[model samples]
Target: MAETKTHRVTVAQRALLLSWAGVTDLGRRRETNQDAFLAEFPLFVVADGMGGHAGGEIASRSTVERLQAVVSAGDVNGPAIEKALEQAVGDIADHPETTDEGTGTTLTGVFFAITGDHAQWVALNIGDSRVYLLRDDRLVQVTTDHSVVQELITAGKLSPEEAEGHPYSNVITRAVGASELTAPDYVTIDVRAGDRFVICSDGLTKELTDYGIQHFLREHRDPGHSVDAMLAAALENGGRDNVTLIIVQVEDEDDSSSPIEDTTE
Candidate 1:
């Protein structure tokens, strides 16, 4: 086993402060990691690609690269991210590797925006990948899935547990690069000290139940350790797909103004 790698980002703006870490694994089955992520401060993302061969890898990598480029150019709001995603869709469509049927990738994560004198957490999702919040030792899923199973669950045609093993569980109704334009769902969250957020692909959830996830999260306070534990648990349970996650913990700058930390295997 290799040592886990962790990247920390600490940002203090106005009355809000944030600290985040990210991790990704190819999992026990996949020969290639079709998951991509961006953990830069003010912007964090996880893209899970679909389509066999190298198509999935290209779709996810391109989506993240374009979004990162847009953020690096000083645009980090919902509209900016949306435009970046649309452009990514176009770029993927133009790629020769993409079939006429079109390859796709699920995008989900959070970005920070300044509202009044405080920074707000803007959560976004376009497919099955999800963003979750943990506060007061309780875990809450923030993003709704855009998959067939989720639609069935919402229509009351299927129960949550039944949807998990449904045949169409991986059939997403929305994805970046699946079409020329993709609209993502966005929500602004109130930020508070001790609020922890988790952004991950369906791979992790496929192997770990919500209760199991909550238990592991409640047991680990450090973002890096929590991420590693989650990934390890997923693999132990038979990693069926690529696993990726970003764990962000909010803290008051007045409580501690620590610099960013990085650790590698």
Candidate 2:
């Protein structure tokens, strides 16, 4: 047998081998984009702001900035992320403008890290914004909708179809800055190649069905284009609310090992 030379790729290249894109829209009726989110390292989020004036925009931006600052200042893990969200929510709630009487926002965040062969991601959500995963051409909702209809569905008082048309469908049961203390639901998932993540506000999901989303994702590879097409579809139906989307495609980090994670805080 002849001896052969092998090349080793650096860790930096492997760290960011994948690409992603995000988009937000004010819809046909809204005058401004009240949503804000982060796409920084190890943290990604989509927040839907609520208020009459610019309060929604302010609250959304504040939440993202606060979380980004906290994670940048120290370490960001499951517990740390939770604490950061709690503190941020408290601070935002303390604002006179973002109270139950006025402004608020719904936050949905995804934190992830890849090391060696293993990858771990966590989702923290407050409000009705959603996180979804597409695997094997199937679209599965990763986070539960935190709305009044969702509560009714869970309690067996309403069927899925009934909840869809419920008059209070948009009335969320939980949201950041709505109260002094808010608990965001956190979910963790292992990573694999060919897995796609979709984070969006209700506007996007409301007008499109799961099958519609799956078809669009399967048809479009560019995250940016996918979001635009989805937004257009929403408008075609009836752009009643704001629309926002974040799409991330995960591929094999290496041909060798599994994904990686640093749970160390």
Per-prediction RMSD in angstroms?
5.3, 7.1
Model 2, which residues run further than 4 Å from truth? 1-16, 90-102, 113-118, 253-265
Tens digits of per-residue lDDT, candidate 2, 1-73, equal: 1111112223424542344677777888888888886765567789898876777887787777777886697
Clashing pairs in 1: none
Q: Which one wins on TM-score?
A: 1
Off by over 4 Å in 1: 1-16, 253-265
Candidate 2, lDDT over the whole model: 0.73
Q: Which ten residues in a row have the lowest lDDT in candidate 2?
A: 1-10
lDDT of 1 by residue, 74-142 (tens): 768877888888878877877878774558899999987766545568899988999999877789999
TM value for model 1: 0.88
Error of 2 at 173 (Å): 1.4
What number of backbone clashes does candidate 2 have, counting pairs of residues 3 or more apart or in separate chains?
Answer: 9
TM-score against truth, every candidate = 0.88, 0.83
Minimal lDDT window, size 10, model 1: 256-265
